[model samples]
Target: MERPVAVKTVAADLLALPDWRRTALARFEREAKAAARLDHANITAVYDAAITEDVCCLVMQLVDGTTLDNVIDCADDGRLSVLAAVSVAAQLSSGLSAAHAAGLVHRDLKPQNIMVDTSGLVKILDFCLVKVLSDTDPQLTITGETLGNVAYASPALLGGEKSLDGRSDLYAVGCLLHHMLTGRPPFHGEGPAELVTQHLTAPPPRLTDCGVDVPAGVQDLAHALLAKRPEDRPGSAADVYEALAPYLPAPAPAFATRRMPPEDPQRPFLVPHGPVMPR
Candidate 1:
């Protein structure tokens, strides 16, 4: 039997609350517009959307999967295997690259907003906080008004910067990667405000610091993505994808299972050992 298609509609309770109606409606509209703009394999597909005086509706692909938050919680070690983590990161980077190319900045990126299916495919979720990178759409966030999950927010967002770009998403990618491998985010605080301050002023954390034995290159990539200065992170999501390709689970089997042939003294080893990340 075919399952019924899921339709996202404004909650009856929300509609009944006069104080929350306007803001909730605006958020619903923004989410619809943002998801509708992108056509990417790793992004959720929006089929349709509409708004009436009191009701908001969005029809989208029924993603039959759990959020990354649940995946993390279900893991016994509180983290994914290295291959699984890399695969998730690569797919996420591809999706973000496509969105950035289309001038969209996913302001709210976190485990709760990323879905992973049974096939191991990733589908980014929720654009209620998405920002359109354009001159006309000035930053809606004012100074001291932060938006996004504190743990995954970029320094710019935490600092309440008036502008954001693809790098902002890249920062959240770094946080996600760190969490996937280390079983926790790179930084944490006792409260939300302190968490934002940590994002703004804390030094990038290393995967090694958490005892995760991933390749040094992966560790460096995480640090680069989490750089306090946006200019220091990978220039774009495309760059991130390139760096993560070798570790992703595809074309090649498990990176840990591949055995390098022993070196012969007579002939020089043509290929270097592993990916050499830039400092």
Candidate 2:
């Protein structure tokens, strides 16, 4: 048998706790397996998963490339190349299209969750935090707390509401695109609570303010994705892709370029650059 890729797995013991905790893990495994069953260029491939007495280890395909978050940090002037940003957006939308078709909502879609391999092949990762709509379990609720990474969460999600679907992920993708173009998320504040409030009430900072020449279509798409009401956003990931299709470069074969040089396996390629926004 082929040896597994050398990637660290989240230990089950570390995640050990009440049944509520395991519920999310179990959902992750189920959705990941479903995602793996689909053949797509933009979705991360799951190799194997084992639940031991103390931990669960999911062996996923090792993607060798920097994340969009890292790319944003190294951008020449706090802005990504328009072409590069569009390409990444296209790939992200494509991945979301597949996931939505399979009834999966990537509750967390952000720069950190997007991995761009050396050849510019973009794959969406970290489905451990995904929300599968068709599952029988009740939506995992944390009383007096919110779920998901605050920076990229949709306004509805940040508002402590439930019943979000693919449109929520679309909002996050819009936020990611905005960040790629401007090197920052749409809303920023002293802390998570403030940011969530901004998501719910504040108008997004204009992309033009970032000193980037973004096209009107791209701007409109961003606005639509970041719309406060989930119903106001694009209907689906495919719809988001369609809106941006005129701007996307031709689709090249997956891994079109030579493999990018590997980073130190011991270190995470993208480190959180700033303090976690307050809550």
Candidate 3:
């Protein structure tokens, strides 16, 4: 019997460019291996993967919901309510924590790559496709490889740093959080180069400046995550989760929510899924 699964195939165009083809193929293989090793509720599970010169495809768990891109687009003014936004960020942080625990980093994190299941659980997609292509022409390959995701790229990553860690991913989470609450990314640019310059030199935009009414602590947390140096950012994804936990809506009696349905992101936290299990 055939089962439902989400299949991700390497873009043929990527393989057509000699600068991207060779390194792209190898990165696909590494991503496959890394993804297969991770198992977490907030992360899309990888069941199988195959890589070759001509083909590279990954089969993943098929989630029953929409991408965060849709979630953002469908929200008021393209932004979630403060409570709902926190819930989504919390889940994303949880997924990041899991990947960090497994010694993996989700280098590319953006709304297009986040999923919100029907039950309101947020799942991080492509947790292991963190590898950016490196070819003979490094700058060209880097820019091409991270096209859509450069908005969330960390300062260190954009600065040509060879080493990356969980902190880098946290920077993207900051961008995510900012985007979710403000209807826009923390930094806006005319092109990739301008965005890179902002991420590298400009201080991250403050939530207060955006006219969004969020808690002071939450705003501070977002700014700290966008810190330039790795050590300056939150120590780990776990730290981020804890910081946002206070903002999660408290679970109400099941009866209370029957008449008034909970929001998309609150569904997973406000309602019980099953008998509680040991953590």
Please provide TM-scores, in order, for all candidate models, with all chains considered together. 0.82, 0.83, 0.87
lDDT of 3 by residue, 69-129 (tens): 8989999889998888889989989888878877777878999899887667888887545
Candidate 2 stretches with Cα past 4 Å from truth are 3-8, 19-21, 250-279
Each model's lDDT: 0.78, 0.72, 0.81
Better of 1 and 2 by TM-score: 2
- The C-alpha stretches of model 3 lying farther than 4 A from their native spots are 16-20, 52-55, 131-148, 255-263, 274-279
Report the C-alpha displacement of residue 50, candidate 2, in angstroms. 1.1
Question: What would the per-residue lDDT of candidate 2 be over residues 85-109, giving only the tens digit for each residue?
Answer: 7777877888888988888888888
- Kindly give the stretch of ten consecutive residues in candidate 2 with the minimal lDDT sum: 264-273
- How close to the true structure is residue 110 of candidate 3, measured as C-alpha lDDT? 94
Give stretches of model 1 more than 4 Å off: 1-3, 10-27, 135-145, 250-279
Error of 3 at 155 (Å): 0.8
Indicate the worst ten consecutive residues by lDDT in candidate 3. Answer: 132-141
Top candidate on lDDT is 3
Q: RMSD to the native, candidate 2?
A: 8.1
Model 1 worst lDDT run, 10 consecutive residues: 263-272
